[model samples]
Target: MAEEKESAEAMISEIHKQITDAFDVFDHEFNKTVDVREVGTIIRSLSCCPSEGELHDLLAEIEEEEPTGYIRFEKFLPTMTKVLMERRYRPIPEDVLLQAFEVLDQEKKGHLEPEELTKYMSEEGEPFTQEEMEEMLSAAVDPDKNVILYKDYVGMMTVEDN
Candidate 1:
């Protein structure tokens, strides 16, 4: 139980670090501050999918306290930590991922060649950026077979082996 608590703390620390890094990118003047208007973009860049209303509410809270129209890192961290701890933004489910893969696996072969998967990922709805495609393909593709074992990919996506 102690170990679990420590692990959770470590995970939260990492999340905070990621948020800080994302926030820093928008802090162009090296002031550790950003315009309140950029808060939603910063949050989304951290991959926290808050609804429009939820984001508006969060911004409203920030704006109320930060009448200066800017937010500092100290203020940003706690708010983001609470949002993350709530798990309001969750990963996609395994079944949904598998069904999406099934659509791409036209012949039902349970796998797809790297080229095939790349084509679909790049050409389909909400096309992945090059870096996103590379990151995903690196994990999903099997060099030995030269194919994406999509079921395994889905497991990697949905399961936390750690």
Candidate 2:
């Protein structure tokens, strides 16, 4: 509801702030003409995005927009937009993930039993399939405890953007 909306807004705002700060840093470091290699370096330093293997692809994509061999801050804006739109590159907010976890962990025992999580996600909300729930649990939950720790869930869902 309102809380979810607020959390989403806060996450978007934080991402925007991070991108703006990166722009400022780039402007100060490179005098308005950044190359593909520089873009890779800067982005790698800024966030865990555009993995090393994806750098070439990112450069190619950016070149389509800028056409020029170098990218100024103005040109960089579109690249940032593209990066933000990419789920693999985008960073979800920990607070938002925690809020969702809280919704699932009604008892607030600091961990969610697999059944509780699976039932909620597969029946109460948007309804993920049984397979999807199993996959998610296998990847993020503790097999021994048969539960998911909030910290582990947060780590799996989001990355440190700063």
Can you give the TM-score per candidate against the true fold?
Answer: 0.55, 0.44
Worst 10-residue lDDT window for candidate 1 reads 153-162
Q: Which stretches in model 2 have alpha-carbon errors above 4 Å?
A: 1-90
What tens digits encode model 2's per-residue C-alpha lDDT throughout 1-162? 999999988877776677667656656455756655567666755564554457777666666464766767666666675576464564458898888888777787989887787777877746877777878988878877877897787877776764
**Alpha-carbon runs more than 4 Å astray in model 1:** 1-71, 159-162
Best by lDDT: 1
Q: What is candidate 2's CA lDDT for residue 147?
A: 77
Task: Give lDDT: candidate 2, residue 46.
Answer: 53
Clash pairs, candidate 2, are: none
Model 1 whole-model lDDT (C-alpha atoms): 0.83
lDDT of 1 by residue, 67-127 (tens): 7878877878888888777766555678988999999899999999988988987997667
Task: Report residue 156 deviation for candidate 1 (angstroms).
Answer: 1.4
